[model samples]
Every structure is written in C-alpha cells, then in structure tokens.
Target: MINACLLNDDDTLKLVSVAAGSTLPTNTIWLDVNQPDDEERQWLEKLLIEDVPDEDEMDDIESSSRFRVGPDGVHILSLFPQRLANDTRGVNMSFTMRKNLLLSFREDDVSIVRLLRYYIRHGKANIRSALDILLSLQDLKVDQLSDMIEDAYSTLDETADTIIEEGHVEENLEELVRQEELNGQILQALYDSRRALRFIKKTFESSLDDRQNRNIDEMLNDIESILPHTQFLANKINFQLEATMGYTNHKQNKIIKIFSVAAVVFMPPTWIASLYGMNFKFMPELDWRFGYPLSICMMILSAGATYLFFRKKGWL
Candidate 1:
C-alpha cells in the first residue's frame, strides 16, 4: 500500500491513500510504500524517477550498498525492529530521501513506521519537511529501542531472582535464552540506526541546518549510551547460562553418586553369596547343617561392615 503524507497549508500533515493510477500530490512530503504490489511499485518508480530495491537487495549487509549518495538523492537501507506475535526480529527498510520527498519502502510493516504515521496524523509530530519526517522516524526508533532495552533489563532481573532462589531451573534457562536473543536484536537495530544516522550526517553536512544536526547528534549519543547496556546484558546472560548448567550437572552428579554408593555397599554381600554357591563336593559348607546359617551371618556382617565404613567416611 502507498500512503502519502501531504503538508497542508496550516503546517499540519494529512495522510492520503494514493490509488494505483493516481498521481502523487505535489505537496506530499513523505511517501510510505509498504509491501507494494506490482502496479504500486511501477507507480512509485515512475514518481521517484528511480527503481525501488527489492526485498533481497534491502537485506544486503554491505555498508556501501546499504548507504549511497547519488545525483537523485540519498539512499539508505536500514534495519528496524519488528515485533512478532511470539518474538522480536529485525526488518530492513529502504529509505530514499530527495529534495522534497522522503520515500520509505519495506517488505513488511515496521512498528516505527506505524508509530511515525500515527504521530503525524495525530498532530503529535513536528514535521516541516521530508528531512524532518526522516529524523522524526529515527528519533522514534531510538525511543523504541530504549524501551526494549528497559524491558530486557527487567526480564533479566526477574530471571536472576529465579536463579538465585533455585526455582524452575529449566524454565529460567529458557527465559534467559529468549532474553539473549531479544537483546541481540536490540543491539543490531541500534547499530544499524547509528550507522544510518552517521551516513546521513556526512551526506547532508553542508545541507542540514543546526536543528537537524543537533537531532542527529543526540540520537548518536543515545545509541552510544545504550550500547554498553547491551554488552552488559550479553555478559550477564552468558554468566547465568553457565551457572545454570553447572547447577544442573551438580544435581545429576548427586544422583549418580547415590547409585555408586549403593553398588559399593552391596559388593561385599555379593562376594559372600558367590563363594557359598560353589558346587564342589569338597566344599566344607555342603556337609555341615549350620553351614547355610553361618554363611548368611557372614554375608550380613560383611554388608553391615561396608555400610558402616561408608557412613564413617561421610560417603553416604
């Protein structure tokens, strides 16, 4: 779908749905193309005078391909955080910023885009030009990353408490793994945002005014501040995982130790029984009546002695 954000006469933004055959409005400051169909893609290509990158191209990891400055405008393919039903992931979106228009193309819906659209429609966003829209989107993305980090922190704290209390070791490990994955996603998003912003700053250094530069600088600083937390969380997750595994191994070893002690305590009784079971005619126990009772007593005393020895040495 293609939605155009037009700047009205009163400085407010109006979101208009651009139909397949419709021409883009002259006052449109931002053109958001989400999972565009073939017709929509052709319309956008004709309108922007450039071909839109496909999903595969947008997923490119090379910085040179991801960020480029050409005669047409600046092109940036940046990763954004997308929340799934059961988890979170990073989605790459292509941004093309021209003199008067900011075009964003994404294969899937991004939370930041939805949020920026809502803010613009609700008069909560202060957007003067296409650049403002881009900066605002980045700013909102940073805010979202911050919120995600805070949530990760809270989750880790709870997991740590559970570990310390020794409650549900398996569940705690699973939660920690999830948190690690989430934290890694957050870190990737932050790194992508920082790199995109840095590229924007360098590309538009001569064109950007004081306010835009300041916004970019602030976002960069925020990213820098939040990076350490991700590292800390990564380290904490690793430590907790190791500790949990150790605890699990300790429990397993205890069970094995019990079985080992039981085997050792019965060894002496087994030896006595084996000796009495011999079928040799010359065996002294076969001719005597008290032989069977004496063998039983000997077996009991040997087993008892083994048990006492183990208990005395604290092996029980």
Candidate 2:
C-alpha cells in the first residue's frame, strides 16, 4: 500500500523505499501513494518542504474557483475519480507536482505505483506514457456508464418495441429485474461522472500546460454533455420498470379472477352431487329405479342455470 517509485535515468521510474534520502533524481522522481496515512503524508511534505493539503484542502483544490502559488514549482492537479453513490471499486488519483517531483494520491487501489516502479527501474518517462493513462481511466468509467445507459436505451427501446410488436414485455421477470439493476448503475455513473468533472474544474490549472489544459477541457465537456441524457435515461428505465411490474401484476390478477369465476360456476353442480351422494336410510336414488337419472338431470340443470347467470352478469 505504501509503494514509492523514483523516476530515474532513461526516463523510467524504479521502486524506492519511502525512507528518507532515497537519492531520487529530482526531475524524474514521482510519488504514487494509495490511501496515504498520516505518516506518509508527513513524508511527502518533508520532501517537498511545503504544506501538503489534507483531504479537505485536496477537495477544495478541485473547485477551480481558488488559485494559489507556492515558492516551488509544485502544481497540483487533482481530479475526483468517477464513482457511483455506492461504488467501492473505483479509485481517485490526485497529482501534486512541485520542485520537479510528482506526487499521486489515490483512494482506490491503482497500478500507478507499479507503473512508477517500472519507470524508475527502466528509467522510462511516466509523464509521456501516463498522460493518456488518466484519460484512459476516465474513458473506461465513462464508457461503462454509457454502456449501461445505452443498454437501457436499447432495452427500453426494445421493451417499448416489444410492447408495440409483441404486445407486452415477456414474462421473464428476470430481464426486468436486470434492467432495474442497470438503471441504478447508470444513475450512479452519471453522478460519479459529474462529481469527477467538478473536481477537474476545480483542480485543473490551464496555465500549467496548453495541451493538458485542452485535453482536460475536452474531457470535461464530454462528461457534461452526456450527463443530461444519462439522467433522463435512468428515469426512463425506472419508469418502464415500474410500468412493466404493474402490467405483470394486472395480468396475474386477471388469471386469479378467472380461476375464482370457474370455481363459482361449478359450485352448484358440486353442491347437488354432494347432497345426493349420501348413503343414508331411504336414499331416493337407492330406492327408485329412475331416481339416478332424475338426480343427474337436476344436477345438470342447476349447473347450466348457474353458468347462464354468471354469463349474463358478464362474470364468465
């Protein structure tokens, strides 16, 4: 968890102990830390000779509303990681550059530490290799969100079309449930993307470099533009899920009602048969030769009358 990489000759980062005086090249040394504790936090501050902002300060740096400069050339670039309200898988990466040293802080476990170690050992340049790394990570999150939205878009489109073409969404119930889950994911992704962009706006210093500034701006716009659609699609998915559930319930109730009516229609016939089935003394069917035929006729007539009455009342 406390892996440190020192960028070395040949433009690479090699693994270095976090102990003091690692003798790292000032220009190539980059610190990649995950969920840094108080001790690690102090170490970075000691090395940089500047007050490293705590979590709150780190968060504040993202607002783009405040600007400050330190004695060293330490430029802070922090971007909130894209995450859902309840997501635990994604990590946030923050870059702090000062005195030709780059420091990264992340909550989610990232491979940046390994990458840095390779940079130092191999003397590779992380700045060039990792420029798109941040973008790639952001793109991954955005694409996942878009896929969920697009899936719902397709499913709802299909559900809508299925309702139009097949007259209703099939009774898989499982598919509808899956759609519900995807809706939650999509909604969460939208919020996460927005939160990340807000951080980008606050922490990004366009004056640092022209190309990076443009890249950040372009990524920000891309996130913002799709946000509205993401929200709407989430809502739409939720609505369709509710409506489909209602329709399924209605269909179930109708089936139960039919069974109830069938039972009602057979009630008279069952009653007649039960009443005459007794083997008591002087039973009519046992005594008279034609009694069986008469009883059967009476039962049939009663059943027919009951059915007719039900049909007349439109209860069939």
Candidate 3:
C-alpha cells in the first residue's frame, strides 16, 4: 500500500492513501510505500521525479549499492530485524531524503512506520519536517533494539540459572546449544543496527544543522552503549556451550576407563588358557587327568592374582 503524509499549515499531519492510478497530492511531505504494485510504484516514481529502488536493489549488500548520494537525494538501504509473534527475521528497507520530502520503501509492514504514523496523526509528536520524521523513526528503532538486547540478556540469565540449579547438563545439552545459537543471531542483529546507525550519522553529520546533528550523535551513542551488552551475552553463551562439552567428555572418559580395566583383568586368564590348549603328543601333562584339573586351577589363580594387583594399584 502507498501512503502519503502531508504536513498541514496548522502544524498537523494529514495522511492520504494512494491507490493505483490515483493522483498523488502535491502537498505530501512524506511518502511511504509498502509492498507497492507495479502501477503504484510507477505512480510514485513519476511523482517523485526520481527512481525508486525495488526489492532486489534494496537487498544488495555492497556499500555503493546500498548507500548513494545523488543530485536528487540521499538514498540509503538498510537491514532491520523484524519480530513477529514468535519468529524474528531481517527486513530490507530503503529511504530517500530530498529537500523537504522523505520516501521510505519496504516490502513488509513495519511496526515502527505504523507507530510513527499513529503518533503524527494523534498530535503526540512534534514533527515539523521530513528530517524530524526521520529522526523520530531512528529514535524509535534505537529503543526497540535496546529492548531486544535486554530480552536476550534476560534469556541468557535464565539459561544460566537452569544450569546452576540442575547441577548437571546431560539432559539439556541440546537446549543449551539451541539457546546459544539464538543468542548468536541476536548479536548479529544488534551489530547490524549499530552499523546502520553509524552510516546514518556519517551521511548527515556534515549536512544537518546543530540540533539534528546532536540527535544523530545521541542515537549513535545509544547504539554504541548497547553493543557491549550483546557481546557479553554472546560470550556467556559460548562459555555455557564449552562447559556442556566438557561434562560430556568427562562421562565418556569414565566409560572408557571401565572398559580398559575389564580388558586388563581378563588378559592373564586368556594367556594361561592359550598355553595349555597348545597340544603335542610329547607333552606329558596333557596325558594326565590330574594335569587337566591343575591347568584349570592355575588359570583361575592367575586371573585372581591379576584382579588383586589391579585393585592394589587402584586401577579398578
């Protein structure tokens, strides 16, 4: 859907829905395009007098392709993590800023954009220009990212608690690994947000006035502060993974020790039986019934002696 938010003379926001083949109002200051159809896209392109990036262009990762400043405006494409009911994934969003107009393009609906619109309509935000709107959006994004990191920290704490209270990790190894993977994902997302904030600061630092520059600076600082917390959580998760692996190896070694001791205890009996079973007609002991009983007794005595030696040495 295409939405045009127009700033009125009374310092209020008026939103208009731009449908296919409909005329875009000339008074629009902010144009938001969400999953635009071909016709809608064409209409927006014609209205802006500049090219609008499609999904593929927005998804490009190259710095040159993602960020560019032309005579028309400054275009920036960034990735932001989107969280639904129980799932989280990244979304590509494109922004274009001209003299007094701002255009944002997204293939999926973003709650941030919706909240911005709601605040503007309800007179809760003191938005005067497209720049103010952009700053507001950035502030909202920073707040959300902070919340995400906080939630991840809480989850890590809970996992750590589970490990401590259980006193063992054998049954929950898989769960621990899964949680570690999740923390890794959250860390990456946090870094992505940090990069976006830095890019925005660099792009506008020279062009914006003092007030806007300070706002951007503050946003950058907020992001920088949160980075360490995410990194700490990632490290803690990795430590948990290593601890779990160590416990598993300990159990395996204990089993191997038992098998080794059993093999050593039976070795003597096997040697004695093998020597007596070697038959030769010249062997006088083989001809006597008493020799057979004596050989059996010797084999039992050897095995018992080996067992006693092992126990004495604490190998058992």
Sorting all predicted structures by lDDT, with the top scorer first, yields 1, 3, 2
Question: Model 1 segments beyond 4 Å from truth?
Answer: 164-167
Evaluate candidate 3 by giving its C-alpha RMSD to the native, one decimal.
Answer: 3.6
lDDT of 3 by residue, 170-230 (tens): 5456655655555565566556566666776787776678777778788878878877876
Clashing pairs in 1: none
* Count of backbone collisions in candidate 1: 0
- In candidate 2, what are the lDDT values of residues 168-208, reduced to their tens digit? 56642455566666555555545655555455445444433
The 10-residue segment of model 2 with minimum total lDDT is 81-90
TM-score of 2: 0.58
When 2 and 3 are scored with lDDT, the better candidate is 3
RMSD of 2: 6.9
Minimal lDDT window, size 10, model 1: 159-168
Candidate ranking under TM-score, highest first, comes to 1, 3, 2
